[model samples]
Target: MSSVDKQLDELKTDVEQQIPNDITVTDVKYEGPELVLYTPDPKRFAGDGELVRKLASKFRKRITIRPDPTALTDTTTAEEKILSVIPEEARVTDLDFHHDTGEVVIEAGKPGMVIGRHGATLREITKEVGWTPEVVRTPPIESSTVSNVRNFLKQERDDRRDILERVGRQIHREQLGREEWVRISTLGCCREVGRASFVLSTADTRILIDCGDKPGAEGEVPYLQVPEALGSGANSIDAVVLTHAHLDHSALIPLLFKYGYDGPIYCTEPTRDLMGLLTLDYLDVAAKEGRAPPYESEMVREAIKHTIPIEYGDVTDIAPDIKLTFHNAGHILGSAVSHFHIGDGMYNVAFSGDIHYKDTRLFNGAVNDFPRVETLVMESTYGGRNDYQTDQADSEANLVEIINETYEKGGKIVIPAFAVGRSQEIMLVLEEAMRSGKIPSMPVHLDGMIWEATAIHTTYPEYLRDDLRDRIFHEDKNPFLADEFNHIDAGEEERQDVADGDQCIILSTSGMVTGGPIMSWLRHIGPDPDSRLVFVGYQAQGTLGRRIQTGWDEIPVPNPNDAGRTSTLSLNMDVSTVDGFSGHADREGLMNFVGTMNPRPEKVLCVHGDERSVQDLSSALYHEYNMRTFAPKNLETFRFK
Candidate 1:
């Protein structure tokens, strides 16, 4: 047998010896990066978790105790037991039994109440049914994306297990002559702020991070040239790690699956849910525009099946020589700052993915410290001189003022927000401000993909800031679902009625006014002098939002008279850009991130920002701290020792 095989056999034997003699270990297997052991009676050691915890500490690997197939009760009895054990007040919504994974997924409206104090209810169910209990939230607003991905995981159980087993064998393979130089290639989103992709490679392993497309027409936009960077086929890729689900950071991932890549995708559970919604929406938008989509929806489904949802700070083996851990990036719902531990201990690299260094209503600020970091790949979206927008308190005050002024004048405030981050933040801001009497409550409208995205956020409240989660679970107050916020129908006939009705505040998607229901709102309100159009997020270059931000009086939009034609509309409504509320750190925040690192990064690479922002941040870090820094263009490669 090979050295890896010998090691695996010895490890299993050692674990078998260490566990209780009475407990029957049905099987001890390496599932992906973690070691899982199946037991005929997991309840024998399930009283206080001491046995499992001790075994995990001894093995020095993630260990999970799963029930053997024979020990598990059938679906009928398992569901009945689960329903009986969980209290009625918990609002159990759905139950899914994943036989392949030996897990019984219990989805509830109030997941916390279902678990009971000290997780007594879950422990009882696990002991009684012999199947591990996994509790997931059923968001007040249901997302089709969440449903599809959950169903995919359930139906393709055999396929997922096979993929994980193969990946596990690959990850644990014997290291082939380590101790070498490391290289990082910026495949996309280097000098400009879209299509963020990168490749990290060593002698034996090649991994891609953030394979996304620039938000524009496929041929017209500059995107990551994956083939050029790899020089090899997609089958050679060891893994693909997503930083977040933003279209600019995840849109092109389906292309990899469509082209022949069937490797595992590493990301947080929330990121997977969001990616499904965003990627499928990308195709739908293209189809509506009478343009061919970059990839069919099936490719997206294929991508979902191969994904491995990981939590923050879980050190996992992706490549033979690479150990990867994700830290909170605080940009969107499940965005992450990837920290790669390369070789035995030769190098450590941290890639900051669109970080917001200051806490917003939805998430906390980005995490700067890591176990080890030698090179830092950072985003500089607001790194220019004088990019410090405003304090959160002052920004909240400013937003209230803008809305009150417009509302008092009998003019509706139409804010175009990005669906993922900004839409949720704006909703909370409006909800809280109204509750505190800072801004009078109006009929707040939510439309397009924003509501579905919000639903996904609710399902993964644990990924949110601690304070927000407390308010949702403990305090029984979820700001996103406040009665004042109205989800407008994503239909033409219903939306036009809102535009013609009495004035109120509307929050719609495509923050930059690039697309989605925002277009309809603008079309109806742009020519009205009394209505106000607010831009609360970044307006990308070349987008209609940026044009209006630059004082464009007339803008071309789809002609309502004919779908095939377009018309120019005069801008008569008030236009305002709130500088605060950006999901990226300013120059000061970026400096603080580097300055606070325990062992300061010796080398820093700037990315995912405009020309000025990236350059300014790189130069500042180099000159101010006397550190080695480089801001490379797309397709540029940087080497680290």
Candidate 2:
């Protein structure tokens, strides 16, 4: 190696020595104002604030360490600057800056107090500074009080579980004496996707179908942990099978480890990759907000150690009496619908794990089989009357037209896209449109995790469209490599260019405008009547995207500076949505899968979709199949035999 290279290596070694043994540096790069270090260990910087300050002092320049993609641990002045402007009543609890990606996060408890009435204080903070402020509150607890509360809750939960177990055993005894029946229960079904947590158990083996989280506003989603299910199934579980990599289907897998469950987590290869990406990402988000993640980084690592990557159609015996197989769910890349064969008799069950009946440029349609399946656990993400499809071609055409029109009027277009699925879809659409001359070729900028994640996607090509994957594998014509696209990883300088560009389309993440590079773009472009901000995914309730979608003319966003000020940026830009890009199956597609299944299922439970979607889908299923269908509320449990 050259002298410079050698010196860099030496620097790395020295830096490694300074960091805790558990924290492994993934990358070391220089941004404008700081040297940024990334580590996969979420607790790398926690409780080591003094060590961080010492390191920063040695550098004399700012230093940032990100344990996860969305989190930062640093002694940057941005937070202090922002804090100065915050009202006295609004106390700052935690502040972090992700220098590698220019993510400035300020988290405070009692955010409402700091935000003031009508978000006046918040507006002042954002307008003055660029830091994205996220405020959360934790109910105060004395150590003694907390212990008492914990014990009480634990005892109560244990009592309930004991009662349920006794009843379950009685039922099992009766069923065994006569005939026999399998019992199933689903946990962690977020209502937005018609996804659920399913538990299936026989005399010999018990299995968790999917584990996940509910959707809500940032800092508002209290942990939805079902200790009874996890603890009960821990020692005796055959395996935990993941359907897809989406958070609602996979987020809580680490929690299993936290609760002393060490069974293998079985998922598709792509699902495995996505889980690694997501679990780390979630840790960063949680850390930045000064909230301890529901599961620690160590637990995530432990979970990873127990993961077994299974390809679709590869049947494996997770237990003496249980067998597992995965089929293409045709949602996002690597999504799967799981099938389980249990017991010696005629007991079998198939779970449609966020199924996508519609074929896409990415994945094939879900399989229609299991002729003798008894019970079906399915999603209703699009299970409502309002859920339908706009042709993909038409949606792309409309998207191109909007961009062309906005650019013709000398406006820039800002699209807040999800980093993984929606970002890839938008990129594909843009590439096609630009190639077809539907719109002028302007610099298309991609920010946030999309660019990095796209590279990861290429590593697992089988999860994508077969034809596209083959072409890229053999001939090397990667569609993700559009000529007009540019990656923006530099600090504020490259951002300024995008902001000042005459006609450009900038795609950034925190699709809901909740955080990430999108905030910077919004701060710059949101006030421009000539600019357009297009939201291409679902905006969960209480997100800035929802506010914009709901026609709020002005909204309060995070101030880039650490000062506790806010900005009331004018929403002069034309706000729009292209819902077709969602990775979810629409209502018609969902219904089609349910309607066409072979031999039909005896019972169906629909969750994960919005209330309207779930109910409509459930109603439709009831009308058509005359089967038991339900749309359960959060934390609500149902037993099936």
lDDT of each: 0.83, 0.66
Task: List all candidate RMSDs to the true structure.
Answer: 2.1, 20.6
Best by lDDT: 1
* After superposition, candidate 1 runs with Cα above 4 Å error: 1-5, 83-89, 113-121, 216-230, 474-476
Candidate 2's error at 428, in angstroms? 1.3
Q: List the residue pairs that clash in candidate 1.
A: 417-511, 418-511
Error of 1 at 76 (Å): 4.1
Report model 1's TM-score to 2 decimal places.
0.95
Tens digits of per-residue lDDT for model 2 on 283-353?
A: 77656545567887776666655666677776655654556778888777788878777666457678888
Residue 33 miss distance in model 2 (angstroms): 51
User: Residue 116 of candidate 2: its Cα lDDT?
Assistant: 65
